[model samples]
Target: MKFLMSILLVGLSAVSCAQNRVSQTEFKKLMKDPSAQIVDVRTSKEVAEGKIAGSTNIDYFSASFIATAQKKLDKNKPVLVYCAAGGRSASAAKDLKKAGFKKVYDLEGGYDAWKE
Candidate 1:
């Protein structure tokens, strides 16, 4: 039981750690480079609620999310994605990376953290 608990804790922490995630400040810096593509992986309703300025909206839940991003973004460039509070963007970033995006970056703590 103790071994199982230890393993679970390690797995959970590894999942929660966002080594690939960058701060809003870092995202802004990355944006200055033409090789960065900024994306907001949130629904239109959430975007209507307000979003990161200059980010392109691609609904993460949509079946076309990956396809749309692939067509829109340069595969050689890094992808920087953010959702309202980070969760969706992280998932989307992973998908983007798996889909052959060279570099996938997520906004740590998402737009909420960025705004504040």
Candidate 2:
């Protein structure tokens, strides 16, 4: 019984910590919220090409990724994250969730999809 209870608790915690993945449409709608913080988790070189307007670039590969996010973003505000593709942003979203951001949204297909 104790083992079963522990498993259930772990499952519940994982669900609570899961970050949301939003489609381009949903992402656009969410961005309309003035309080939302948009984050681009791409390398500096990649971001130099192009990026979402109003997004703050925080390299996911940087050792200070989470720390930089924690410093720049408001924990109380919703965060929308993207990368050149979906991969890095997905990881960033998870990290942001673990860092205790109240709401984290990952852009599906990332900046590529947004451009399309």
Candidate 3:
């Protein structure tokens, strides 16, 4: 029963995470808006592989992640976040929201999904 409850809680968290995520098509549409802010939360090494054109790379793993985001991103605009995989981007989106960003969008399945 405890294991089942844990699974249920994990499933619920996943559902909530999905709510903030967008498919590549939707992400592209959002990107078309001039007010969109693209933030790549991948590490420097991962970014060397290439990123979406026009995205600002902000390493999520860095100790100064939140500080850098606060300094670099506009809280008033819509933020589109992506990482090597979906996990970090999802985390970054939550952090952005807590940091007072009005709109936050995560890349579902991350950059891998985009490449697909």
Candidate 4:
């Protein structure tokens, strides 16, 4: 019974910690919020080509990715993350949540989707 309860609690915690995945339209609307911190979790080279205006570049592949993000972002504010095509950002969002971010959002289909 105790083991079952523990498993249930763990499952509930996982569900609560899941990051929000937003479509381009929802992402755009959320971006309008002044307090939202937009992060591009792409390589520096990829970011150089183009990125959302006003977003901060924090390479997802960096060894200190989670630590850098924790230092750079405010825990209280909403964080909006994107990658080239939704892959890296999804991973980054999970890391952000594990690092104690209360509200983390991933851009579905990433920059490609937004550009379309």
Screening candidate 3 with a backbone cut-off below 3 angstroms (N, C-alpha, C), the clashing residue pairs are none
The residue-by-residue lDDT of candidate 1 on 1-116, one tens digit each, is: 99999999998866744667888788888888876778998899989989866789999999999899978989888888999898998899888878888888888889888878
Cα lDDT of model 2 by residue, 1-116, tens digit? 99999999999977764538888989999999999999999999988989999999999999999999999999999999999889999889989888899899999998887887
lDDT score of residue 97 within candidate 4: 85
How well is each residue in 1-115 modelled by candidate 4, as lDDT tens digits?
9999999999997776453888888889999999999999999999988999999999999999998998999988999999999989988998998899988999999998787
> After superposition on all CA atoms, how large is the RMSD of candidate 2?
1.8
Q: Comparing candidate 1 with candidate 4, which one achieves the higher lDDT?
A: 4
lDDT values for all models: 0.85, 0.91, 0.91, 0.91
Of the candidates numbered 2 and 4, which has the greater lDDT value? 4
Q: If scored against the real structure, what TM-score would every candidate get? A: 0.80, 0.86, 0.84, 0.86
Cα displacement (angstroms), candidate 4, residue 93, comes to 0.2
TM-score of 3: 0.84
Candidate 4 lowest-lDDT run of ten? 13-22
**Residue-level error in angstroms, candidate 3, position 3:** 23
Over the stretch 10-115, how does candidate 3's per-residue lDDT look in tens digits?
9998787677899898999999999999999998898898899999999999999989998988899899999988999999999888888889999998987787
* Model 4 spans with C-alpha error above 4 angstroms: 1-19
Q: Candidate 3: which stretches are off by over 4 Å?
A: 1-17
